[model samples]
Every structure is written in C-alpha cells, then in structure tokens.
Target: MKNIIKTILLSVAVLGMSSCSEDKILDLKPVNNILSPDAFTTPTLIESYMNGVYNAAAIGQYNSTGANGGRGYVWGAAYVEQGECRGEDVVNMATFYDLTYSSTFDATSANNVYYWVDGYRLINRCNLMIEGTTDAVAKGIITKAAGDDYIGQCKFLRAITHLELLTYFARPYNDTPGATHAGIPYRVVGVNTQAEIDSETVKPRNTVADCYTKILADLNDAETLITTGNSTAFASRVVGRASKWAAIAFKTRLYLQKRDWANVIVEGNKLTGAFALTADPYAPFQNTTGRNTSNSESIFSIQHAATSNPGVNAALASMLKDRALVCISPIIWRDADWKTDDKRREEGKFIYTAAGIKYTNKYTDVTNRTDAAPVIRYAEVVLNMAEAQARLSNSAPALTLLNSVRNRSLANPFPTAGNPVGQAYTAASFATDADLVKAILKERRIEFLQEGRRWTDIHRLQKDPIASVATNGVPAKVASAATPPTAAFVLGNSFAITTPVAAIPYDDFRFLWPIPQIEMNTNPGLGQNPGWN
Candidate 1:
C-alpha cells in the first residue's frame, strides 16, 4: 500500500500544474513510468495506475486562489454553473465580474485562467488513463471486472469535466438553443485514427443536442462500469465515485439544465433511495465520524486522507497559507488576524474563545488535522430529492423534503435562538410547478451556501427571477470606507457583525467566459464564447 501510494503521489501532484502554461514543469514520474505498458503488467500495477487518474481529477494545488486550483477543484465548475463572480470582483473595479465575463467575447483574465486549464487538464489525464487501461487489459494484466471498474471511474470523471465545461462554454441543453450553441470539444476512446486526431481540429460548435448526447453517453457507460465495482478510500466505489447514483445525479442535473422536469424528477428519485440522510445532518463532517462516515445520505463522495492533523489550519492550510490576500473575505482567510466574536465588525471567522473557531459543519474536527475533503454528501442527496420533488409539482411533500434539510443547518432554518430568523419559505398556495420551483430554489441557496453550489445553482435556475440572487442589485454601504463593518454575513449589534443586504447584480454579456486569449492565439479553431471579444 505504501509503495502504491508513493507511485501515485508523483502522478497526482502533477495535476496541480493545470494553472500554468503547457510548458509547465512535469511533476509526475517520467512519462515513461506513466506510459510503461510493462508497468501495468500486473493487476496491482493497473490498480496503481488507476490512482493517478482519480487524484488528477480530484486534487489540485491548495494554494491556487479558487477551489478550481485545489482539492475542491469542482468549485470552479460550480462557480461557473451558478454564474458566481470571483470574490475579488466585489472590490476590483478594473474587472468586469458576471455572466458577461463567462461570455467567450468578454471574459475576465482571472476567469479565463481558472476555467479553461482546469477542465482540459482533467480531461487529458482521463484520456491517458482510459487509453492506458485498455492496453493493460488487452495484454491480460487485469481481470475484466477490474478493467471495467477502472474504466467506469474514468468515464464518470470525464463526464463531469465535460458537463462542467459545457455549462460554461455551451448553452444549456434545450431543443431550441442547444442546436445553435457550440458544445465543448468532444473526444472519446483512443486517439488512434487520423479522423480522431482531426476531430480535435476546430470543428464548429456542436448543437446543444450533440453536446448532451456526448455527455449522456459517457455517464451511461459509467453507470454500467461502476455499479458492480468497489475501491479503497482513495479510489471509486460501486454507486460511489461517479457511480450509478452520480451518473443519475448528473443526468438529473443535466435535465434540469435542459428544463426537462419530468425526467429530472425520475432521475432524482432514484438518487433518493441511494442514500438516506443520517439522524444528525452535520455528523458527516464532525471531527469524530467525519473521515469514516458512510451513512445512507452519501451516494457519492471523493474521500480525502489526512497527511497531517485536521485543524482548520491543516484542513485548509495549503489553499489558505499563501492566500494571505485572498482570505480577507468573511470565510477562512489566512492572514486576517480576526480572532474575536464581534460579528458586526467581523473578519473571516468568529473566534469563540470557548468553542474555538466558527467552522462550517461541512467539516468539523479541524482541531489539528488535515481533514479529508468530502466532495459529495448524503445531505446533497436529500437536497436533490427535495428539489426534484418541488420541480415536479410535489409542493406539499417538496416543502417537507426542503424542511428536512433546513431543519438541520447549524442555523436551523425553522428560526431559533441560534439563528434568530429562519430563512423565509412561502408559496404553498402556488398555482403551478413554477411556483413550487421558486421555493425549492431559495431553499437550495440557504442549504448550499459557501459549499460552492450557490453560484452554479443560480446559473442553472437563472430564468426564474427569484431563484438567483443579483450581486450588483445595490452597492453595499459600509459603515466606514476605511474600516467597513462586516455586512453580508452580519446581522448584529454594536459588537456583533452586521452584514449588508448584498444582491447579485448580473450583466448579460458575461454569461459565458471569454475563451482564453492564449488558446485562441494557438488553437485557431477554438472559437470564443458569445460575448467575449
């Protein structure tokens, strides 16, 4: 096991290079060790090689600014999915932050750097593993089942990467717009044929139909491969890492984007039975049971192993350490020196002298450890079920589903001494499916905040005005320009934090990120998204 870990660490660490130029240093063992057909000559070798693919897809440099740069690399796609502006955009006057930036014609420099390289780098690793595994199996190294499982995990990873790209680069799946917009550059299987290599050549944008067809194909394939599989803590699982449920989840997600509510409901219900929410909703991240919890609620989760203690410092040190400047936000900033309980005039965290730091329940027990990152959780399944039900006009039961999650937040949504005022949810008298959806969407915002789903959900639910928060609705008014009191997260007294009622002010043009200028200059066929110049 130790040797397997070491063998793959070199390859996994190399995935951190996506942020840099193609000339970026190669951190993996020689492409020779990577490509050695002989190396995968054993079942162990093939299994070890599979590790490289998972790590590459899931982990990234902890120091990079956004979640895209590190272990929560999914954060990038989530951000784009919801049209989240970079945290920097809140204060950076020079940059235009919104869906307008996502437009291929007018993307910001930061947006371009994060989204493009992250997805492609993941895609490349997936391709390498897929191609390599086939050779190993052909040469009689791995059993048919072993090969099937590896391929399943690989396909699942690839499907997510492509869908993530599609949400940003292509139009949402609709019979109308999908056919017009360009889907991402699609490729599958071995790059053996001239046609295959040429397929990489600039083909004009795929119809939204074609883009979805490609994604569904990958996910369906993943469904077959992952259902009967099992993997260790660092690997995939049956109905686990991009497993049957995940494939279904993604399909539900895809159909939601496609605005196909009936199908979304069908797929989402299947996910519901996969994982039952635990009695204590926050137990998944409690320091004690966090790392090892496999309750029914978690349909799919990318498990992280600790190399160090699990304190916030260790849990998030890699990303927060060098981000002294980035941590100024109200979350877990590194150099903010904000050690107190003054909520109104607060910093990243409220230092509870007694309870310690105010941490997100998504991860607890950050006392002195590098806690594993849970990418997907049972709570999400509960949330997904509630949402799908609401979208399908099951309003009465939907609200019940919604309340199940809301009742669980640290700030219980029902309103209490802890959370003084519950997030409001109404419209029980709604006349149609659309009305119930509005309630469901709002419920999602309160449920998934900061977990990196807000922005993406906002993007997915854009058509409905109430579903997405407008960032620029009104400029925030700070108590004092120099020493602005905490406003967004604050609702407090003189000593308590008093957050401003911030709104999401979106610009039409920044919808799809501008294609990277570097890519455009090099890959002539790589046309930009709509609005970016």
Candidate 2:
C-alpha cells in the first residue's frame, strides 16, 4: 500500500504536464515512477532532483509550433514581449500579433490561464524537493546542512512562483489594503496521493494579505538558508541558483508591489555594495562574450545553453527582429525622443532599417537560444530605491540615484559639462519630487523596454486609460484619466494605420484578468475575479 501510494504521488498527473504557451489542457500521461524510502539517500540524486526543480521553474511561454513565430509559447524573453506589447513601449509588425494587444482577453484567456497553471507546476516541483529533503534528513540520507540548503532553494522558488502568480491573478496588494480580495490558493505541501490532490484542489483561495504573508515568510526563510560566504566560487553557480542576496532582492520587489515604500527602501539597502552596473551599456546581454559568467549586476538568471534553448521561434530575436514578427513602437522613437547616440540605439540593441522598421537586439541569437533570462538585476534595485525615496519625498537622494542610471547609458557620468550625446536624462532635469518620480518612471520604461515589465509598471503606477499615439494628427503623449478619444491611431495588419481605438480605463475590469475558467471549474470553492465570469 505504501509503495502504491508513493507511485500515485510521484506519477505525473495530467495537471502536471505543461506546454510551451500553456494553451493545451489534455488527459494525464502517468509515468510509473516512485520515490523509494531511500531515494534521497545519495547526494547525487538530491542534486539531480533540485536541478529538475530549477528547470521546472524556468519554463515560461514557448510553444514550438509552426504558426505564431513557429513557436507554441515564448517564455523568458516572451514575458518582456507580452508585458510590453499591451503597453505603449513596443509594437508588432504586420505578420505577428496576439490577444495581448486586443481588448478581448479575460478569465478564459489562454495566456492568463497559463500563468496560473505553470506557476503551480513550478510550486509543486519545489514542494516535492522540500518534502524529499526533509525526508532525507529524517532518514539520515543527507546531513542537516545539505538538507537546509535544499530546503532553502526549494522554498525560494516556491515563494517567487507564488508571487508571480499573484502579480497576474490577484489585484495589487495595495489596491485594497484592508479589503478581502481572493488570492490564489497557497499550497506548500507536495501532492503525492489522490487525497492530497483533491484536498489541495478544493482549498479556498486565501486573502491577498494572507498570501503575501506566506510569500514573505518563504523568502525570509530562504534568505536565512542560502549562503553568500563563498563569493568567488558561488559566482559561477549563482546565475542558476538563488543566493542570499537574490532572496533579499526578491523581497525588494515584493515590497514594491505591496506599496510598502519604506520597506522597499529598507530591503533594497541590503544590496548596497553587493552588485554594480555593467560599465558598457549593452554588455550585460551579450550571449557569447557577455553575461556568460555571473557578475555583480545579475542577481539571478535562467540558464539556457547553446544545445538547449527555449526554441527557435520563441526567442526575443524571433519576436523583435527587423523582419521579425514584433517591432518597436514608433512612439518610443518619436514621442519619447530617444537620443541619437544612445548605446541602446547602437546596431545590436535597436535596429532601424530602410523600410522604417525598428527591432530590439537584446536577444541577438536566434539559432542558438542560449540567452540567459534575467529575473532580477542590480540596476532594478537602484531604481526601486530611487522610486521609493521619491515617493517618501526624499528629494535629493532620489535624484542622485536616478542620475546614476541616466549617466551610465550615455557612457558619460554626470556632474561633468553639458549634456553628453546619447544621454537620456541629467541631474538638472527635474526640480520637484513629483518631477523626479515621473523621470524615474520614464527611465524605467527606457531601461526595461524589452524586459517584460511595462504593463505591470503601468498598472502599479495607476497610469491607465492610455490613449493612442496619434489622434487626428496630434500626439496623445500623456495617458488620459478622462474618457479616451475615439478613432485613435494604431499600427494594424501589415503595419497599416488603424484608428478610433478605445482607451483602457484605470479601473477597467480587463485590467485584472479573470480567474482561469478551468481552475474555477475544478475548484468549486474558488471565486472569479470581478468583471470576468
């Protein structure tokens, strides 16, 4: 009976099989696998299981089909693409487009559903590692120290995966500080038996606050267990695993989402001298010469080798190349007024061709999908601190931090002379805290253009009801809080100009994606988010 139970628990359920784009929901293909009582007895087996957890966590939207960039789902770089596509930062060319830009996606939407399904898949893997590690220690299969390390890593993945789900599924925690908004069900235990699966499935969703509490606890525990003592040796391994600093950085992001401005500052300060910005503007992204080794800048990145990448069609190169499916928005080129010599505009970063198309070069290698997926970077922490300070009305300090990022892009450190060429912003640019805050926001848009953050940033800042680029021959530069203009200009099929596009309101129901319909179907206790039934 025990052997049968172990097999049932270890077997891959239909619910466990995740696809590239997360579109497919099929029947279970159970494997006859079981964890013997002493499966975690060897260090090598434990390491292999932990690596599997990492692999599961890194899987994002990449579907390897012929259509849709010949890919099923685009995961790593696709996150940046999907997040920015909905916002005003990037554009799609004639050949490629998706529901991300459409005003129609909701709870039944496959893209949104994928986030929930894939996230829990990651969490489940982590839970298994956590359980196996604990069991190994209890059975004297591994030392207490080794067990702690395994447990810490698994918990860190679980925490971040849960947080990512909340970012999509639940309203921002700050949206309703004291209110009871249903967040995704918090499951920490690995499902091994039918009873465990049933129990977890029917568990009611936790309140957003309660969910946050769990996320923070996991992060804090991870921080305690993950080591940073062996910096030199660990640097090579840190790209794939969570380090002590990585846990702290994740907390910084979590605080920002919760709108805990002071806590953001508090947590961000922990990385004071831990990481530095890459001296060259584009050095951090080069797959061959750059970022092959861990640096002070990258806290954690998903590792993809030359032999193993997300796929051909699912890479950023496929989506944002000159003749590629997606393109950069004209607004970024025209309205935002990017400098001519900006390193970001250099041939490899953004390409401008004779046909008047713009492509981002962040993911330059298409044939070999070895580009590391950046989860967190040192620069983001600096900006988060800058924004937090500005919000707290700490004027002088915020501007100083903001200028550091601005100076790096131009390759011209500030407090020098006149505006050096390629410089995006300067120290004397803003006068008030609000002005500094706005500049910081603008800088974030420029900095993380293809890093999959525009929509969430827009959502967090409450910058909504965004209007079209050109309305009746004039630029609707600033997002309108009032009613949007009808017949707004847009790039449509074949790059043709389409007009009268509706603006999304700040409190639009679509802003908060509906709970995945299948999840609601399976878990009767789960309730749908507002505006999607």
Candidate 3:
C-alpha cells in the first residue's frame, strides 16, 4: 500500500514526485494571471511556469495493485494454478496498473497520470510561452535571450517525461521493441483540439524506436542547454530537474537497453572514477547516515520528500525504520542455495530476531537506516562493464571487475581451488562466457532483491531464469492453448503446472500491451500491439 501524504518532498532536484494538486491550483489561478497572459511575457513568469512542469513529472502513485488484488493475494492465487514461481509477464500491468486506462484513474494513481500529463501539459504551456515570448520580444514584452534559456528547459522537461513514459508504458526498447509497436502519443505543444481531434485526429503512434530517438534528441538538446554547472544533487538547476550528468546517466541506461555493448564498455569505462562501490553493498540502502552512500556509486535519483509518501517511498518518519512492505522473501533464501557465504545477505537483508530467526532488516528505517533509494549505482556500471567484456570475448579479465565487487561482499578471500588455465581460474567452474553471464544474473538478483530491478533485468538479459518462490503462473486457458492441456478441469478447481524456471515465457501475443480497447474503438487510426487478442 502507498502512503498518501499531502506534504511535498523536500526536493532539491526538480524530479518532482510531489503530492501537490496542480489541477486545483491551475483552476484557481488568479483571474488576472489568466487575464493578463501578459504576466507570462517576462522571464520570471516563464521560468516559474517551467518549474511547475517538473513538479508534474515527480508525482505518481508509489504502487498500484490490480482490481482483482495486490501482488501477494493475486500472486498467491496465480501460483496455485500455474505451479510456477511467478509469471513475469504479469497480467495486471496493462490492465490494472495503467493509469491511462479509463476506470483506473484516481488520486492514488493520479500522480503518475498527472505527472505524465503535467509534463505534456507543461510542454504545451512551454510552447505557448515560447510563442508568446517571441511575440513579446519582437514587441518588447520580454528579452529574446531570456526566452531561449526558458525554451531549453522546456525541451529537457519534455524529454524527461517522454523517457519515463517510454520506460513504463512501452516494452523495453531493447526487446519486443517499440519499432513495430505503437508508443504513447507524442504531444509536443499543448493542443486540446478535442472536437477537431474527434473528427480528424490521425496521429499514428511512433515506433518505440522512434520514441527513443526523440528522447535522445531531447536529452542531447538538454545537455547543450544545461551544461553550465551541476554541483549539488538537488539544486533547482540539478535536483528535481534533469542535469547534464543526469541526462548522460539516463542515456547510458537507454544505450545499455539497445545492447550497444561497445558504448556500454566505453561509457562505463569513462565513468571509472566517478562512483565508489560500498564495501557492503546494502549500506547504500540501509545506512541512515550513509543514505547517499552511492554519491560515489549512484549517478542520479529523483530525491523525494520525507513527508509525501513517507516510508512507502523514501523519507524520514515513514515507518521505513520499523515497517516492512518491500522485504526479502524465501526466493532469495532459496536462490542463495546455502552455498555462498551469507556475508552479503547478512549485511544486506538479515538481522537476528529476538528468537534468533534471521529476519530481514534492509527496509527497517532506523535500525538499518538506508534512506537513499538508488537509481543507478556504481556496481551496475561494474556489472555492465563486465557484461560488455564478456560479450566482446574478453571475459578473462572480466573477473577482475566481478571479483572486485564479489570480494567486498565476502567474509574473507575465497581460497582459490583446482588449477589455473591462462586467465581462467582452473579451479573456478564457469565453462564459458555464457556461464559467467548466468552468474552475473544470479549475482544481480542477490544484490538487488526488492529494489525494483528483478523484472526489468529479465527484460534485458532474456537469457537466464531464476527460480520463483511458490508463486507465478499463467492462466490455464493461455498455457493449454500453447502446450495443449494434459487434462481438462474446472476454473475454481486448483491445479498446478510445475516448471523448473521461475519466470514463465509470456504467451507470445502478450509481448506488448493491447492498445486499450477504448482507444481501438474510438480511434480507428490507432492500431493494437501484437499478441493481444
């Protein structure tokens, strides 16, 4: 469940994940401000308007479950039918979690929708401001130089919104791509041509690839515009807003998705000295004093106010010190296999309870006060670099970086075993680079459990499958259609189709979301994505 605090996050960066009510504020704007429209002719008014757009981007539901139920119960029921750990192609995403879906919009989920709409809404506003300011500059209402800077900020805000939307609404740019797929409508300038749109709106969805290109263009444009100085992580120029480094960091992630391995190696190499890995990987998440521990490892994060969503997101006074929603399950316990030293998990998730049962304390606020929510940590760079090297057949040295991270998590140096073959440790048992990658996925899971990275990592790797807990399964109708039913059964009767892999392959048609049925009915031009019925 998400906490619905009415307070704004103490934000430095304009990564505006706030609880502020914009529609109310906008509706209640002073008549003179609306009437004078001339007020927005000045640089001060234009900048203030631009800042509001960032506020729109940050405010969204921290979590939203389905109409049927939240993950635990629905997942609990799902596991009973499928006998699988968890179907990663979760059915609720497009159906239940989509804020744009007609019935799902509410204040709880409104932030995400509002955040998105606000960005575009602001984009329209920016366009209006630019047009007006140009007219004003020509007539002496404002200066041309001031107007240019304001427009650049608008571009950055527009790009950031699109990027976030692309990540959420569309499939990963690297996989089941947006090229053939229809991305969210690309709205640049504000236009509510509803009547005209109803009759003549023929905007074809851009391919996911096209959306990525647009995102890159905006970021590139933002870099050129925002390249002055970004010292503070949360300054008005940097925090709550996109900065040059923040843009690059985001670019790096996009490139990684496209599997531009060379760029991954290059960009990752270039960032060599920027991030510092923690001796204890969990410290960045649990240490209150060391919340921004990843100031060394993390590139950027949309810092939240301790008041908005409270601990449900990241802030003080939010039972994060004492409460638990996002916690380690038996999945990690089973995955760790009792083989590796518990050093990482011990430091990362587990704390001895009064009865001595090892209870997870990672999300416990004060006891393991890791206030920082990492967006991109240095270890990811290290992992990405190693992955790049492995992909390049230079895996012999990849272990150096891998070992660098592994050693820190270990209680003591692992005594080398067996023999040595060239750079390959003879005693170590990874038959090939593929084996190493499998290991990397396993390591990533151990390190990033409950950090919102598991499902996405699967999108990128698409190679390995970890075992899911006694959870996750596909609908019987779907599973039988492909593999064919071994038997017939009633809907309520419980049955299981056990599989070794944790994540079941999504029925092929499920690769992308069905264009919402309403959209299909209303807009003949908008086509549905493949795999939907």
Candidate 4:
C-alpha cells in the first residue's frame, strides 16, 4: 500500500490529463517534485488541482496504471460489481465477477488488489490536497474559508475511501467485541519525498473501532467546514462535490453500520428539509436527460461525462444492462414481497428483459457509458433512520419513514385492500419490533437492488443478534447458466434453479476478501487477513 501511494505521488504530473479543459491544471511538464510551494498559486489552478483529486478519488479515471493495469479502477463499474456480486441479490453471468460471486478470490485477484491500490492512491491525493490547501491559506494565496472548504472536501473523500476499504478488508463491527479486529491503515498524511515514503511503508494497521473513529472525525470536520449551499465561487458546490448535507448523510450510513441507532437518527434529522426523495423511483438514474444532475434525491454521486467515462468494459450500463454480464438474481426479483406492478419492476424502466433474463436499466447510456455512480442518496438516509427507529421500538415513525420511500414506486393496488396495500406497512402491520426491522431490511434490499448496497446490508447484519435481520453469510444463489422460466413472469412465480450454489457460512474466512498480495510484498510489516495464502 505504501509503495503504491509513493508511485501515485510520483505520477502526479499526469493526474488530470483526461479531464476537461477547465480541469487540465495538472498537465504541466514532468518535474522531480510536483508538490512544490509554487504549485498552489491562483484560484483556477487550485480548483483544478482539487478537481484532479476528485477525478482520481471519485471518478477513478486519472491513475489506472498499477495493479489493475488496463482495467478501470474503483468508483465506477469495478466498485459496483465488487459490492453487488459479493452478495446473492445479483448473479454473475459472465467471467468478470465470477470469482467475487463464488467467494473464491485470493490475495492476487485483480479486483481485491486494485481496490486496495486505487483506494490508497485516492487517499494520498486527498492528503496532498489537504496539505496544499492549508499552505495556500497560510501564504495568503486563498482565503481561510476557501482553504477550509478544500480541506473539508479532501477529508470527506478520505473518509469515504477508508470506509469502502474497511467494508471489504475488515470483519463486521459486531463480529468481535468492541470491533477490535484488524482494519486498513488510515493514511492521513501525503507521501511526496523519499523520506515520507519510507516512513509510511512500515505503518501498522489500526483496529476497526479506531478506523471508525477517524472516519467520523473526518466527516464531522467536513460537515463544519464544507459549504452549505448549491452555489459557490468555485464549482465545488455542485451535486457531485461534497457539502454539509452530504457529510451529514454519510454519517448516517457510518452510524447505521456501527449499530448506533441514536446517532443515525440524529444525523438523519439534519437532512430532513435539505433533501427529499424524487417522486419517481427511476428519476435518480436518468443520466442521458440530465435529470440526475439536478436530482433532489441524489446527495452525492460520482460524476461521469460522455468524453470522460469508465469506458465500455467498466461502465455500469455496459455490464448490467447492455452486455448483461450480471443480472438481477431471482433470489430478490421473484420474492413475493417485491410487487409485480411496482414502477421499479416495469419493463424498459428500471428492469429490462434481455434473452429472458432481467437486467437493471438504472444505467441507460450503453454507448457513452456516462452513468453517474451513486455514493449516498436521500432514500438511504430515510431507510437508515427507519431501521434505527425500528430497532428502538419506535414503530410508528419507522413505518412512516419506510412508506415515504416505498409509496412512490407502488402504483397498482393489491387484490385485497387494507391499511397495508401494495406492500405498504401500517402501524398495526408488524406484530413485533423484529418484524418491523426485518421489513425495513427487506425494503433496503429492494430499494437499493443494483446500486452497490446489497453487500453493505449483508456485511453489517451477518452477526446481528436479531435472527430475522441477520444473514448467515453470502446467501444461496442461482447458477450462472440457469435460465429463467419460459412462461410469463409473475409476482409469486418460483424460478427454480437446477444448480443451486451453496452459501458461504458466516465463519468462513472467505467471508472477507484477502489483503492484496502486492501490499504484502511491498510492506512486509502489514499483516494479511487469516485464511488467505
């Protein structure tokens, strides 16, 4: 990891070469030290440099030369595939994510290796931005407010990158008491000179609890310093960039993962009037028409453009919709809970049929592949608060919050009408708090089907004390080659699988991905996750 960060720092000269003309600040001549004092001069240059950091971290387009070589790195298709295929909600129908689907990935697998390499690469860029912006403020090149905003954005990116790495590399927070398991190294400083690189190479991993503490600290600082409105002197106020609400929304996710119910609600309440879910469930995924650009539901997303995309192989539309590499698994698609008449299930809208298999149409730009990757959404914050309320036995507010997200997509009425029509729950619907929590979990599975959120639920719920909300491990999945039923699909139809893949037990070491072999080779002091050679 340290060696990879050193390489990324050294290669900063070619950082934003593929970005637009406004973002071409880093296309300067190669130099021995690109982070010299003169690098942070004008507002345009500083903003462009920060744009390069965002391009590397959120867009994953700048540095694609290391462990994953030609394949696009994380924050794009690789990010979506890794998160979705690890669980049973999505089936891997091609070779791209087969190893991930079957939990057979080793330390040398490209997916895990590149995820670590690119994640730290992004983190190092954020560190450099932090240092550069602070220096610019001290030298009076930029105001204190401007410098703080830049630092806040860097911290937000840094926090998110570390959280993503923890989801894959470390065990669940509840797997052990106090979350004392090994966590990834929280890189807070930039690696520019040879001495800094040497010092970073030997840093040991931190505990999961420690990692979460650092993540929350960064997010809190970001919430305080980041701008609040949608407009600013620079382009940092756009939807894709971090803001006060985005930091708060992300804190809900982190607190939810840690099972801190009160904190989740506290953070969620801060976003009550700031953002709201779109009336249409499919509104947030419309990229070609620019509806997603001003989507009220999207809190923060990874921006992609026609000229600057993850390419055909790694684009979300290409893999999930056009090429049909992975499709919506029957495990969730055929469940009786997901209504047949729901807007999300309507053909050509969110779900599309190709060769009798259902693929997600959430991403529509197969040619341009410019679909924006969603990081956090208003729906997720609502659901997080809903689950937190249910856990606390506050059933009334929980059901109301759940319906706010669920009612929009429910267009048709069920055959038997009552308070709970079309799968909308009421106050008397759940007999127990566990049942309400289970319903909230199911809603999460349905609402966030292909948005790279399935694995997050599975990871956090694996060791849950409540039996209904807990998952044993990766659930049973349909065979990759198994064909859907020839008859017309119905809400309750059972799509029998001729070859059922067994589930990985919670105790299996494969439950968590191995530390990349490259990291082990470069930093021998770093320990590997058990059960991987």
Worst 10 residues of 2 by lDDT: 467-476
**Candidate 1 lDDT over residue span 1-533, tens digit each:** 11121111111222222222233323332122544344467776666666655554444433243222253344212232123233211221112323332222344354444455555555655665677778777977777777777787778777777777676665445424445666766645333223333344344556667767888888888878874433333223432256666677777667766667677667767655445555654455445554424554555545445432222322333222221111122332221222122121222331211122222334333333334444455565556666667766677777776666655443334467777665434444467766666556654544443344544554454444445333332223212122222443343323333334233344444544565555554454656665565
Q: What C-alpha root-mean-square deviation, in Å, does candidate 4 show against the real structure? A: 5.5
Which ten residues in a row are the worst by lDDT in model 3? 73-82
Ranking by lDDT: 4, 2, 1, 3
TM-score per prediction, in order, is 0.70, 0.82, 0.63, 0.89
Q: Is candidate 1 or candidate 4 better by TM-score?
A: 4
- Best-to-worst TM-score order: 4, 2, 1, 3
**Using lDDT as the measure, which candidate wins?**
4
Cα error, candidate 2, residue 508 (Å): 2.0
Q: How many backbone clashes does candidate 1 have?
A: 57
Per-residue lDDT of 380 in model 4: 97
Off by over 4 Å in 4: 1-38, 59-72, 228-237, 287-291, 412-423, 467-471, 481-494
TM-score of 1: 0.70
Of 1 and 3, which scores higher on TM-score? Answer: 1
Per-residue CA lDDT of model 2 for 296-400, tens digit only, reads 577777666664444555555555653466655555644344554566766645453434455677766666666777777878888999988988989777887
Residues 1-533 of candidate 3 have per-residue lDDT tens digits of 11111121111101222123322212211112332254365666655555434333333222242111111111111111111112222111112222221122332343333333333444444445455555667877556655555555566656655654454345655456335555766655433223323332345667778877887787676656664334533222333344565565556666666667787776666556545676665655554424533334545443433332222322321222243211223334444332345465463354323222223444445432224344456677787777667667677667777766666776545554542222222226577776776566566666554444454454444422332311221211122102212221112234453322223344344333344443344444656555443
